[model samples]
Every structure is written in C-alpha cells, then in structure tokens.
Target: MSKPTPLSGFPEWLPAQRMIEQNVVERIRATFELYGYAPLETRAVEPLDQLLRKGETSKEVYVLRRLQEDPGARTDDSLGLHFDLTVPFARFVLENSGKLQFPFRRYQIQKVWRGERPQEGRYREFLQADIDVVDRDNLPFHYDTEMPLVIGDAFASLPIPKATILVNNRKVCEGFYRGLGLEDPDQVLRTVDKLDKIGPEKVAALLVETAGATDAQAAACLKLAAISTGDASFVDQVRALGVTNDLLDEGLEELVRVVDAGTEYAPGLIRAELKIARGLDYYTGTVYETQLQGYERFGSICSGGRYENLATSGNERFPGVGISIGVSRMLGLLFGHNALTISRSVPTGVVVALPAEELRPACDRIAQALRRRGISTEVAPAAAKFGKQIRFAERRGIPFVWFPGADGEPDTIKDIRSGDQVEADAATWAPPAEDLIPVVSKA
Candidate 1:
C-alpha cells in the first residue's frame, strides 16, 4: 500500500499538545460560563440549502457525501458540514425560538469545515470557540462592545504575551465607500481586505484599475487605510476627510461607540482602525481581528464581525454579533515558541507504583482515593522495577509518586521536580495547591 497523504490545513497534535488544546478550550468555556452565558450544542449537519442560505458563504462551504454508494444511488440528499457556529446557531434559534429566552446569551464550541485552499495558519477542519448574544429584534449595542473584551480576557489569561485586538465597523467602511462614490462597496471591501497581503501601493493600483476608482479616490482610500492610532485623533482625521455624507458620519459614530466602550472597561485594549476590512459579506455592523504583539506577520489568529439579519429558518430572526478563536493557529504559535504554554499534559497530581502483582489493588485504591479528593492520579500499569516505574511517573509529569510502603508508611509521595520524597497517608496527603492544579502561561 502507498503511504498516506498529509492533509493540508488540518493539524493534528501529539498527546501532550492535545492536553494544551484542552486547557485552552476549557479556559474559554469557563470564562463564558462565569459571565452567565448558557451553553448550547447544535447538530453537526444541516440541510444544504439551510447551510448555504447565504449565497456568498455557500462558495467556501464543503458539502458532505459518502463515496461508498453508486453515483446513481438514491440520495440521502446533499448535506454539508457546518461552516461556522454562527450560521448553525441562527438556524437553531429560528427552529426553536419558542424554547429560547430573549437576549439569549450562549456559547458554542464545535468543529466547522470550510473548503478553501488550506494554507499556513488556515485550516480545512478546526475547532471554533464562539460566544454570541441573539436578541429578540435588535442585538444590544452593549453586547457588541462587551464581546471583544470578554474574548480579549480569555487571550490575556492564556500563556501568550499581550494581544492587541483591532476593531472596525462594516457600516463605517460601507458608509465611507458609498460617500466616495463606489456603488459596489462590497468589491471595494474585498480589495481593502488584501491590503495586508499585497501592500497599500499595490492595493491602490488594483482599486483604480479594477474598482473604477480615480487616482484621487484611490489615494484617499489608501490614506484612510493607513490610519491607526491609540487616541481619538482618528475620529478627527476621518472628519477632516471632508466628504460630507450622512451615512459616512454615521459609520464614524458607530466606530466611536465601539472603541469608547472597549476602552472604558479595559483602558487601551481596543485599537480603532479604519483599514480593517473583514472578508465576510454578512457582517453589517462591527468587524474585528486579533494579532499577537510579535506575531503580526503570522496574520490574524482570530476574527469576526456583526451581522444584521443572519438567522432565517423560514421563521423569525436570530440577529447576532460574535467572534471566533482559531484554536489551531493560536496553538501553532502557542505550543512551540515562547509565546504561550501550559504545564505539561498528563497533568498527573499523583502516580501510584505497583510493587508486586498482588500490590496492584492497593495502588488502584490509592489512585481512586486521590481522585475522589480532586487530585488526578495514575497507577503504574504493571509491577515493574522501581527505577522504571519512577521514570514512567516522571515522563508523565506526575508531581507526586506514591510508593506503597505496607509496613511503616502506607503512602509516600515524591515531588519529581524537587526530588523531595516524604511519607504520608493516602487519605490526608495533599500536594501544593498550585501543583494540584496545572500551571498555565500568562501575561
């Protein structure tokens, strides 16, 4: 048989790395829960038409079908893998609106499939952690402001260095574009989205050549894209653009609101940027992208925006604004480099060694008691040499090695990191509180 092919964009980690992934996800879930956001999980597959209801998103979606059957086989029909949590959540809310409470706060953790060309930091299959609030008619503007800070806190709490989240509003970009005479504002947004990839000079050339923008218009667009500042001066700069369009002014106001709210809570957390052009067509209000401080060239590790009327299940609406954390891309930076980390996987609090064949039950009992006391314990698989067993425990990063001393000491625990071994009883034995819980990287 030939060797298996390496699938692009779908990253798989070793056991240790998976433990780190688990920690990252659990932290996000915990943060969401702490804020009184209820958890909801939707089915993995939806009707193809429902999944691809949005014409633009349909292009990137991957349709799922089994290949074992004949080509002419009577269909189980076209069912596609859910692309993102937001779309499926919309359909779920619409299908079950009666069951949901208004201003429904929810967090969804699931895998979404996108059939785009897989490249570095981009994936065909990945886990997305999303939290959004879907209101009865209009999603609260405060929810729009609060979502980013909550997400930023999750990143800040992680082992990664300080992260900066750049936020912009789609309405603002659209208003500015329409005021500047681009009837096809969507096309202009698409061109601007590539500003980081192709550089401003090239993007300006493309705008004039393809988007029907005059040199002056292109120059103005380039100038607007280049503006990013910590202070409110950006508000003045856009005002100075002197293109008096009511809609443009409205967009600018929306930006001010989002930036001000973000700043009030975290004080210099959100950066107001004019050039951020999020690629998704559905975002009608706010758009966001996150980059690590020294890892900007690695591109946006997380991004999302607001959508006006996203939910339509042949029923009422489920309008929402939320963000997604690219678990894989973030980990790509997190696992290997100095950016982020967690105490090793196999975060075993205690490891019980087996002295002989008959001593195994005691080891099991010891492990069970430790686990009952909220300690993660692992018992040696076999009666092996003490050196070998100690290595096993050490390899797993198990801090405490409990060796059964039947005669004098019933339980003896060892601190692998410090080589401190002590005698104690299993029922009352306790490790350091920090060791009981694994150490994770932080700011």
Candidate 2:
C-alpha cells in the first residue's frame, strides 16, 4: 500500500501548537464565564430544511448518509452537518424555551463544518468560540452594543495581535437603500456585502445589473459603505449624505449608541463602518466584522450580528445578538506564519530518572508524591545512563530531571537547562510557578 497523505483543509497541529490552541480556548472560556454567560453545546447535525433556511449558505451545507441503506427505506427527511453555530443555537432556544430562563446568555466553543472550497484562512472544518444573548420577547436594544464589548474582552486576553471590530446595522443599509428609491434593499445589502471579495467597481456594476440600482444610487451606496469612524462621528458623516427616511433616522440613532458605548468602554477598538453589510439574511440589526492588525487581507477572523426574528415558536419571538471567533482559522493562519509559540511541548514539568531498572518502584513513588503536590511529574521510560536520561527530558522540553535517591540518600533534582543539581524532599519540592504550566506567547 502507498503511504497515507494528509487532507488539505483538515488541520492537525503539532504538540506545541496544540498547547497554544488550548491556552487560547481556556482564556476565551474564562472571559465568557466572567461575564455571567453559561456554557452550551448543540449537536452536529440538523434537518436539511432548517440548514437551508438561509438560501445563500445552502451550497456549503454538507449532507450525511449511510453507505448502506435498506432498499425500501424512506429518505424524505434528510440531515446535514450544521454549517454554523448560530443556526443550531436558534433551534435549541426554540426547542427548550420553557426550560430556559429569560434573556438567556450562552457561550459555546465547538467545531463546525462547511463544504465550501478552502483557501488561505478559510477551512472546511473549524472551531468557533461563540457568545450570544437571546431574549424571549422584546429583546433589549442595549444588548446590541454589549456584544462587541464581550468579544473585545475575550480577544484582549489572548496572546494574538489586536483586532478592530467593524460595526454596521441592517436598518442603516435598508433605510439608505429605500431613501435612494431602490425597490429591493435586501438585494442591495447582499451585493454590497461582496465589496471585500470583488472591488467597488464590480460591486457597483452588479448593483445596477442585478439589484436594479441607478448609477447615482450605486454611487451613493458606495459612498455610504466607505464611511468608517472610530467613534460616534460616523453619525454626522451619514447625516451629511443628505438622506432622509424614518428607518434611516432610527438606525442612525442606534448606531450612535453602539459606537458611543464601544468608544467609552473599548476605545480605539470599535469602528462604525457603514458599508459592512453582513451577508446573512437573518441579521436585521447591528452586524460585526473583525480584522486582525497587520492581517487584513485574510478577511474577518470573527463576525456575527443581531437577528430580530431568528428563533420563533407560536407567537413567541426570540431575538439575539452574538459574536463568534473563528478559532481554528485564526490559529491556522498564525501557526502557518510562525506567529505563535509555546515554551514546552508536553505538560510534564519534571521527569524522574531511575538509576537502575530495579528502582522502578522508587521512581514511581517519587512521581506520585510530586503529583500529589499539584506538580506534573513523569517517570523515565527505562533505566539508562544519567546523560541519556537527561537527553530524554530535554527532547520533550521537560525543564527538570529528578534522580531517585539510592541507598537511603535524599532525592536530588537537576535543572536540565542550567545543569543545577539541588537536594530536596519529594513531599515539599516544587517547580517554579511559571514553569508549572506551558507558557504560550505571540512569536
């Protein structure tokens, strides 16, 4: 048989890299919990109809089927792996509405799949860290501004470079489109969403040919998309556009509130970029797109928005605002570029070396004693020369090597890097606090 080959989009990281990934996840989880958000998880598969509710993402949905099926089995209702966490969360809220509390806040970090072709930062299977606030009815508008702040906290705790969150509201886009005398505002929003992929020239042409916008209207849309400010100054810029509509007025006010809060709380981190039309159909309010500093070409590493009517059941509407960090994608890009690092490969802090195979029991006892003291300890695989034992610890990035006491002598531990040998009792010995756990940092 031929040697096995690795898949392109399915990422597998080395031991040190996985350590960095775990640290990132823990930091994000801790931040989410600090804000009073509970943890949640949803199954991987959902009915095909539910997955296809958003028409644009249908092409990326991956369906699952058994290799062998009964000849007469019915296949009317099919299943597909969920392309995103938001869809599954919406279903969970509707299914468990009665059991959950009002204004439910949840943080979910899980793997999601998409069948789209992967390139650069995009992946077919990836991990996402998502936090959302859902309400039974009449969701508070203040939650819209709070979404980015939560994301800001999570990202700030990680070792990666800073991220700038670009904010936009669907009401802003729709109102401006209607004010321009455009009949289909949704189509215009979708077209404008492609501004990053295709240049503004192509977007403007498509707006005219597909969305039925006049040259002046398309220009106006382009101009609106170009308005981005670090604070509430964007409101004055939009007002300067000379557009007047009730929805536009309302959207402007809401955008101002969100921008002002972000400025006051997470100053210089949030920006009001009017052209950020989130492509998702369900997003009826504020939308977000995040760009990592010095990595803008890879596109948004995190994004989400407010959905006013995403989850509904028999007259009860659940509206929510959320943000999702594309964890796998971010890590993959950083790892590929050698931007992340971990000081150690394995969790073991010290390796106990046996002078002879007969001292296996003693080595085991020493390891156990250290472990009870909250220290990570491992025993050398076999009895070998002192130099060989030291090499074993060095190869795995284990900082220290412990020699088992012979003939009733006290235990001695050697700091492998410095070759400093010190006598100590197994019960009271401890590694430095910084060396207890692997250190992850930005390279």
Candidate 3:
C-alpha cells in the first residue's frame, strides 16, 4: 500500500515533544489544584442549540452524525462537537446544580474541536486548559481579578515565554459606546476586535458601515481601545476620553480592582488593554486576552472572560468568569520554532540489563524493586552483550543500566553517560532527582 498522507489540522507530536507537552500540562494542573480548583471532564458533544447560543460560532461547530443513518430517523437535528469548554460547562452546571456547591471552581483539560481552517497556532482539534468560577445568583467581582492571577501563576510555572494578560470589560465598552450615542455596542465590539487582524483604519470603516457610527464616533471608539496601562491609570485615561455613564463608571471601578490585584499579586503579568474586546456577547463584565511574548502575531494563546448570564435555571442565574490556555496551539508554535527542549524522549530512568535469556525474571524483579520506590524502570528488551545493553540505554536517553548480582555478589549500576559503574542494591538505589523524570525547558 502507498504511504498515507498527513492530515493538516490534527497534530501528533514526537516522543520528545510529547514529553515536553505532558510536563507543561502537569505544571498547569498543579498550579490549578494549588488554587483549590477541582478537576473536571465533560462530554465532547453538546446540543446544537446550546453550541449556537454564542454569537458567530455556528460556522466553527462540527456537527455529529452516524454514517449510513437515515437523515429523517430523528425528529430533531441537534448535536455538534463543542467548540469550546465554557458552553458545555454551563450546561454541566445547570444539569447538576443540585449536587454542586456555590462558586464552583473547576479546571478542565480536554480536547476541543472546531470546523475551521487550521493555521499557525490554530487547529481543528486541540487541547484546552480552562479554569472557571461560577456561582448561583451574582458571582463576586473578585473572580474577574482572580482569573488572570491564576493564569499568570500557571504560565509563570512553565518554561514558555512570558504571557501578558490583556484585559477589558464589556461594561466599559458598551457604556462608552452608549455614551457616544451608538446603539449597537456589540457591533462596535465585534468590529474593534478585528483591530489586530485588520488595521485601525479598516476597523473604523467597518464600525461606520456595520455599527452605524459616524467617522468621529468610530475614531472615539479607537481612542478608547488604544488606552492600555499597567496599573489603575487606565481609569483616568478612559475618564480623559470624556465619556461618562453609571455603567462606565462601574466597569472602570471593577477593572481597576482587577488591574490593582494583578499589580499587587503578579506584577507586570496583567495589563489593562482596552482594545481587547472579546467578541463573545456573553461577556458582560471583564474580558481577557493573553499574548505570548515574541509570538504576539500568533494571536491570543489564552483567553476568556466574565459572563453574567451564560448558565441559568428557572428563576436562577449562574454567573461566571474563566480563562483557557490553548495547550496544543502553544506547544505547536513552540515546537515549530524549536523553542522547547526535554531531557529525554521517554520516561524510563533505568534499564535493567539482561545478561541472558534465563535471567529475564531476575531482571524483571530488579525493575519492580526500583519502581516500588517511585523510580521509572524497565527491563532490557534482549539478552544482548553488556556493552550493547549500555548502548541501548544511551540511545533512548536512559541514564543508568543495572546489572543483577553475579553469583552472590551485590548488583551494580552504571551511568552510561559518565561511564561510572558502582555496586548498588536495587532495593535501596535511586537515580538523582533531576534524572528521575524528563525535564522540560526552553531551548
């Protein structure tokens, strides 16, 4: 048979790259659990109506259907692979609201699919790591501040480049546009969100054409978008724009709180960038967009926002704030650039040397002993010569090779890289802490 062609959107990493990705994900999970966020997993598909509730996302949803099934067999056509985690999470909360505690904090790491053209830092199927805080009735404003701090800490623990969390609030944008007499703030938002893709001139033109704004009003919106600061100074900057409304003031106060918390906790990690108008309509308050340093053109590698009414039950509202790290996008970009490195391709720290086929069980016992003490060990595949066994470990980046006791003599271990062999007992011996697992670092 001929060689199969490679698929464009689905990424499969090499063993070394996979090791780095797993290390990065474990670090993210550790940071999330440190903050008391419980782990969660949700179904990959959601009802079509639930997926379509968010504006402008229908084009990205991958519908699910069985092959050879009659189209008219079902009364309703209502299932699609979820494009993002937040929507399904909202449904999960509503479905199990009774069994959950208020202010549910969850961190979900899973694969999400999108039916869009794949490019650099974008894929049709990718892993997303998300953390969200949701509560019945009104969710506290502090969660908006906390979301970025958590993300900042998570990214900080990883070896990737620094990620600056750019923040904005729907209240601020909507109130400012309303003060300008523009009736459709959402249209203005969707247009301004294209500023990074399309230039400011085109965004302003689109605003006038699509949002029904005059050229001057469009210019004013650009001015607001241009206001970015590392501290609460953004509040005064927006005030200087001469837009005033109760909602604007409220948003300004909430944004200041978020930025100030960021300053006090993770300085220089979060910035108030007014241009980050997240296109989702559910974001009623704060919105966040994260740009990796030196990879800013790849777009936001992490993003999410505060939603006041995404989840609800009868006469009840579950407000929430969240942020998601594009795990696959991030690793893909890094791997493409050759920016990440791992200590080895596999996790085995020691390969028990096989002297003869008759001694396979003895080697297996040695491996088991090492494994019981939290060491990663494996037996040599063949009863090759001693030198061949050492070379086998070297090829896979395995640090040590263990030889079983000759007759009644104590067993010995060899660090192949160093050519140092020493008498050791499997029941008591251990590799150096750094050698126990693959270490991921920036190249």
Candidate 4:
C-alpha cells in the first residue's frame, strides 16, 4: 500500500475543525430563518449556456461529461457544474413562477466549484450561504437596504469579528462617468474593479486605453472610487465631487436611504464606497461587498447586487437583490489563523463505563436513559480498568464518565475537568447547558 497524497485546492477539516464549521453553518441557517427566508436548494449542474450567461465568470466554469456515455450518440444541451447559486436560482424562479409566491425570499447553503487558483482563503471547491429576494416586475428599493441589514444580523450572530458591508450603486458610477463625458462607463467599472488587484496606476492606464477615457476622466473616476463613508455623509461627499446628473441624483437619494436604514438599525455596519464595481454585468442598481473589520486586505468575504432582469419569460421580468457569504473562504481563513475553536472533538457528553462483561446491559440501559433525556451518551468499548476508561473519555474531551453501581447500589458520574464525582440517576441527571453541545470560541 502507498501513502495517499493530498490535493491542494480541496479542503477537508479534522473533527474539531468541522465541529466549528457546522456550528457556524447552523447559526447562519437560524439567522436566515429568523428573517423569513425559506430554505432552498438547486441542482448541482445547469446547462452550459445558462452558467455562462454572465460573461466575466464563464472562464471559471467547469464543464461536465459522463465517463461511460457514447459521445456521438448524445444530442442535448451541454451541461456544466454551477459556479454560483444565483444563475440556477434564477432559472428555478422562471420555471416555477406560477407555483411560487411573489417577492420570493430564499436562503441557499451549498458547495460551489470554480477553476481558479486557490490561495489562503480561496478554494477550488467551497460553500456559499446566499439569500435572495425577487419580485415579479419591479423589486422594491427597500430590499437593497434589507439585504445588508440581514447580513449584519447574521455576521453579528457568529463568532467572527465585526463585518462592514461596503455598498455602491451602479447608477452612481455610470452617472458620474457620464458627467465626466466618458462614453463607456461599464468599461471603466470593469477596469476599476481591478484597482485592488492591479495598482491604481495600471487601472488608470486601463481606463484610458481600454475604456477610451481621457486623463481627466480617469483621474475623476479614481477620485470617486476613493470616497467611502460610514453614514449619510457620503451623499455630501459625492455632491462635493460636483458631478450632477439625473441618474446620479437618483442613485444618491437611494444610497442615502440605504445609509439611513443602516444608521437606524445596524449602525456603523454599512459603508458607502463609490469604487466598488461588482464585475457582474447584470447588476443595474445597488451592489454590496463585505469585509471583516481587521481582514480588509483579504478582500470581500460576502458580495452581491441587485439585478434588473435575472430571469424573464417573454416580457415578464423577475428582479432580484441578493448577497452571498463565502462560508468556506471564511472558515479557511479563521482555521488557518487558529482564530476559532471547539470545546470538544466529539459530540458525546458522557461515556458510561462497564465494570465487567456481565454489566454491559446495565451500562447500555443507562446510556439509553441519558439519550432519552436528550443527552449524547456512549458506552465504553470494553470492561477496562477505571483509570483506562477515564483516559478514553479524556482523550476525546468527553466531560463526564459514569461508573455503574456495585451490587445494585447508586451510580456515580465523574466530571473529568474538575474530578468531581457525585451520585446521580441516569433518568434525572444531565450535563450543564453549555456542555450539552460542542461550544465554539474565538481566539
């Protein structure tokens, strides 16, 4: 037999690490439900054309093929693994429009695959927690604000650090570029989206060479991207830029509403950043990007935007706003830094010991009694010495070890951490609330 080599991009966690991941996911799921978002899941694969609808992401898509299929005999749409949840979700909405409720809100947590190079917080395969709200025709502007508030609540509920949602309006950037007499605003946006990747100077060069922007226009765009505020003051800052257009005015008003809502509800959680050009072409309105307070250099951990027509049937349009949290990316970062921990490596709260092979049934009954009371219990594997049995429990971080009664006397449970042993009845005894499940902590 040969030792197996590990794959670089695919991530797998140990038991304790996975415990933290599961806890984080459950917290996110509960938060999504709290906001009235129903759980939904889409198929793992979609038509290649459907997955490639968004041009920028097409190169990242992984095409699918069956190993045993006869290539020449097949005649069907080419299929590919979904890169993100949004595209399939849009297709789902359009297909089930008649059966679904209007203003549909759904939360999806699933694994997504991408063909990009993996880094510290990036993986070829990962999990995403997404929430989207779509309306039949025109989606309300309030949803743009609600999206961030929901994100704020979810992040606040987790053990992670405080997160800031950096928001921008596509209209703001388009109007500002128009005010500067730049003919192709989207090109400038695509270029500015690379500002963090390539330096500002390269982005400025790209704006001029590719987007046909004059030096003054490129400089103005750079300046606009530099303005970011925590509250409504960003409205005044954009006004100070002296770029006035009808679309710009509308965008500023909407942004003011979003900032105000954040201020009123989740203060200091939202930031108005003009330069955040969410690279997707479908985002026609508000766009969002989130960063952990101390990990801004790592880039956005969650991001999304409002699409005017994510799904359509003839003239009917399904407008939607959404945000997706990169669960795997976040956990990768946290786990790499040893920033998160679980109190136990296993779920068992108590390990019932057997004094002899004859006492096995007694231990089994006691284990059943504890389990009936909603406590996780496991029986010792063998009738080993008391010291060896305690070691087994200690090795797995099991807090309590139950020693059955001798000669039909009362049983005793030992708290390994404190070495406190006391008489207890299996039906009535229980571990403390905090010890009932693995506790997650942040370093």
What lDDT would each prediction earn against the true structure? 0.80, 0.90, 0.91, 0.91
lDDT (C-alpha) at residue 130 in model 1: 86
Model 4 C-alpha lDDT per residue in residues 191-239, reported as the tens digit of each score: 9999989988999999999999888888989999998888888888888
Regions of model 4 farther than 4 Å from truth: 73-76
lDDT of 3 at 410: 91
Scored against the true structure, residue 332 in model 2 reaches a CA lDDT of: 86
lDDT of 1 by residue, 271-310 (tens): 8888898876778888888888877888888788878788
Point out the worst 10-residue segment of candidate 1 by lDDT: 335-344
Checking candidate 3 for backbone clashes, the offending pairs are none
How many clashes does the backbone of model 1 have? 1
Candidate 1 stretches greater than 4 Å from native: 1-3, 69-77, 313-315, 336-338, 408-410
Better of 1 and 3 by TM-score: 3
Cα deviation at 136, candidate 1, in Å, is: 2.5
Off by over 4 Å in 3: 75-77
